[model samples]
Target: MKPSGTASAHSDTFARDHLPPAGQWPELVFDLPELLYPDRLNCGYELLDRTAERFGDDRPAFRSPDGGVWSYGELRDRVDRIAHVLTDDLGVVPGNRVLLRGPTTPWLAACWLAVMKAGAVAVTVLAQQRPTELATICLLARVGHALCDIRSVEDLLKAQVPGLRVTAFGGGAPDDLTQLAAARPGPYRAVDTAADDVALIAFTSGTTGRPKGCMHVHRDVLAIADTFAHHVLRPGPDDVFTGSPPLGFTFGLGGLVIFPLRAGASSLLLEQAGPKQLLPALAAHRVSVLFTAPTAYRLMLDELDGHDLSALRRCVSAGENLPAATWQSWHERTGLRIINGIGATELLHIFISAADEAIRPGTTGTPVPGWQARVVDSDGEELPDGEPGLLAVRGPVGCRYLADERQSQYVRHGWNITGDTYVREPDGYFRYVARADDMIISSGYNIAGPEVEEALLRHPDVVEAAVVGRADELRGQIVAAYVVLREGAEQSADSLCAHVKSELAPHKCPRAIEFLPSLPRTATGKLQRFLLRTSPDPHGRVALE
Candidate 1:
């Protein structure tokens, strides 16, 4: 990696000091004109203050659950006040890792922008994280200051992190962030930070063991808006956005916050947005653009008749693979094509996606305008168009793990080697096969877990299905399926096995079928395959049927 052209604006260099060695950095490619960012850039100012200046200040930026709306000017004013609190009151300097813990709300969003405006590295964690998880993250980031929601501060306090300063928000108390910000209503200048300075460190979800912090810079933050949102999504200022992902997840941060703000659009912040609440919220708020996972889409399909979805024009699915079955069903029911994309926290947001007429069902569309991707074999050699191999991507924004040894594993030969197995079609569309570790090999037959899961989803009685390779003595390994059936539906394991055999090859059928009320998922709605793989089976190993 080349040395940064501009000097950093950070007084506290902990974030920069902990960055992985220069040799471990991925090759960042800026092949597009929009990606040429200036040296001094502040993403928070660009998204809020500059947006209010370019667009009208009176335009709505965020909507709350209690019928309150914050306009662009209002949001900028709030962010500036909070910036003053972070710098003047909290003594937080640039590059200091400040942990942000809260539910999805306007206050939480303001706190995030405040950290960015003050040039501090934000370490945002999920509110559902336990004390141990919190402690682990704090230690890894060397967090010194924290801004938390008033109600969710208990767990953070229980963490008992050494020398951690916690400031609570969303309450009337004297020390609350809301009260403190209100006390100082004047405008605060945003720091002139180098575009390459660390802006945030997003940790991987619990779906993987021992979360690795993904470091992203200010320029990287805006690149997502420029590449994916600008070229693919084509969101407009009039669109009202909403999603189920919390701000802690980069998917949610991009879809619900950055993308909308960059487009001069607005978003409705929801604290409780499962399918039941999401359906009603979408109709009531007239949400035009929806961002969520395929599981939520499947669950809401059953309740579509009761809600009016005339206002929704765009739908984005991420956080996990979107089954072609779910995409087709949604389009058949709503007449809106779901934009399927694959993104990683390390890269910050969606790098590959398709929208509207460009979308080919079952295939993740071509890489976004600023990005390039290809399929490569285990030896990192380029694979044929029709062959399945590891997915390698290079773009304006790339992976940068914070002080983690896994950096070498993720970035190789100047490309981000995402651990997903994929196929590059002759037409240039990418088809996901499975996670590299998720491929089940029984005897000599290779079977993709998602392919089997897709077949199981086609069954009328199957609400959800997860397939994993179980240890076997004779067959090497066998496919085991854990399924959640439709409510009140009962089908024998033999019947389900027959259904799979009819849909796919007989060898792909699960040898052991277990009924689960629900599959395990992380707070971000990602399937916790590791959990399902580790969960104890009540029955002992089954013989080959």
Candidate 2:
């Protein structure tokens, strides 16, 4: 049950061995080379066709929470029918953007596939988003047609965006996707999309302001499947993939859609993915590969004693840093090491992750194959090993943010500066420091909020924590901790503050603590530190804080 020996064993080879002495790391393994496309088509339609042909009707291609299963042949046929509906019935054509809003159900998946098959761009919106946000994304993407779930129609109607044609899935006939699938053609030719043709437009959380649409080409999906899947997950036709990420998020899209389809594997889509729902679903579906965030893993470990997780062979964690404690605890309980990676919405998917056998606790292993990364100073000069600096990367797939000057600021000299501070070791592993904007400058020392939060999580009483800089008259800014304690654990504010002081360095401990019932999170389950920074409880309004 030890950290290194718990999962599938492999060699201890480190990425440092492959690093170049001068400029960048070369010969990194990527995922795109392993795909099987009919002809040279780069669209997702080709990927689905290849999967159907390879797997046929052998097993389920997709499964739902209620045990509804669709074989590859059945799924492909439905996708074709939906494609016809998109083109002939709805007047959708190639080059148009179709806004797709729904949960992670089979219909959503089918609609997404059908959109790409019809040669239109698919713009995915998170199901949990409010009507305002949904409308904002729809307008930004200039969507004229929509394929949505029955539940989300109310919200869409409330948004009242004009010139939008709506079609519901799961309900019967006319507008319902089920009836359209039954009546439409079973076989449709795949669109011959170019590699550079835009396939999807994913919007980021836009913590600074309005969400920015990230345009990804057909090649990007194939590139991610080839880079991450071939090198990291290494999934096969028999692997049963399951995850908690929503289909709207790139993490979910890559793990649940691209990875499984490219590998000819089956995936389970859960409309709700809390620990309660996920644990039982894992057992019922016999999911072999699990993809989720660190917080969910910690929650699962707390409640997974009797669950049959023996079927789980791989667990991938992203969205946030994975604590060494959570990684070790899960491995001990489930005998699976959670593969940790650092991916950005702009980058499409994971560009740095550890292979199963090469995982090092507390590190975002190495640059993904075909990608090169370096820690550099503000001037873009590469820093020596172990020096904390801005993490810059150059890879096959890069960011093209929607009409934002910030994109240029982030992408400099062909290397995309992730705005994250990191420390590169002699062994080629990168240690996350802090987001450039999130670093707390207190008394001339740079304090990383996430690092302090990670330390706080090691304490048994603390269930969740968010650390940010608070305004201070003397120090300009001081570390403040917003903590959520475990159930049945009671501690005074003073005592809890003292507990953190005892566990961490005096300077690193929070200057003040605010006990909260729960931490604020984005729809994707990422902690929202921006909200915490603006709170008066931390400190009176101050620029640095």
Give Cα distance to truth, residue 508, candidate 1, Å.
Answer: 0.4
lDDT of residue 22 for candidate 2: 20
Q: Write the per-residue lDDT of candidate 1 for residues 1-545, one digit (tens) a residue.
A: 44386899998887788787888788888889999999999999899888888889999999987778999988988999999999889999999999999899998998899999999999999999999999999999999999999989999999999999999988789998888898985798999999999999999997878899999999999999999999988999999999999999999999989999999999999999899999999999999999999999999999998899999999999988899999999999999999999999989988888998899988988999999999998888999999999999999888888899999999998889999999999999999999988999998999999999999998988889999988779899789899999999985787788889898988999988888888888888888888777777625233336
Candidate 2: clashing pairs of residues: 28-369, 28-370, 29-369, 30-227, 31-226, 31-227, 32-226, 32-227
Across 187-300, the per-residue lDDT of candidate 2 in tens digits comes to: 888666655556788999655557887777676688788887788878999999888999899999989988998888889999999877889889988999988989999888
Q: Candidates' TM-scores? A: 0.98, 0.91
lDDT of 2 at 171: 66
**How displaced is residue 282 in candidate 1, in Å?**
0.6
lDDT of each: 0.91, 0.78
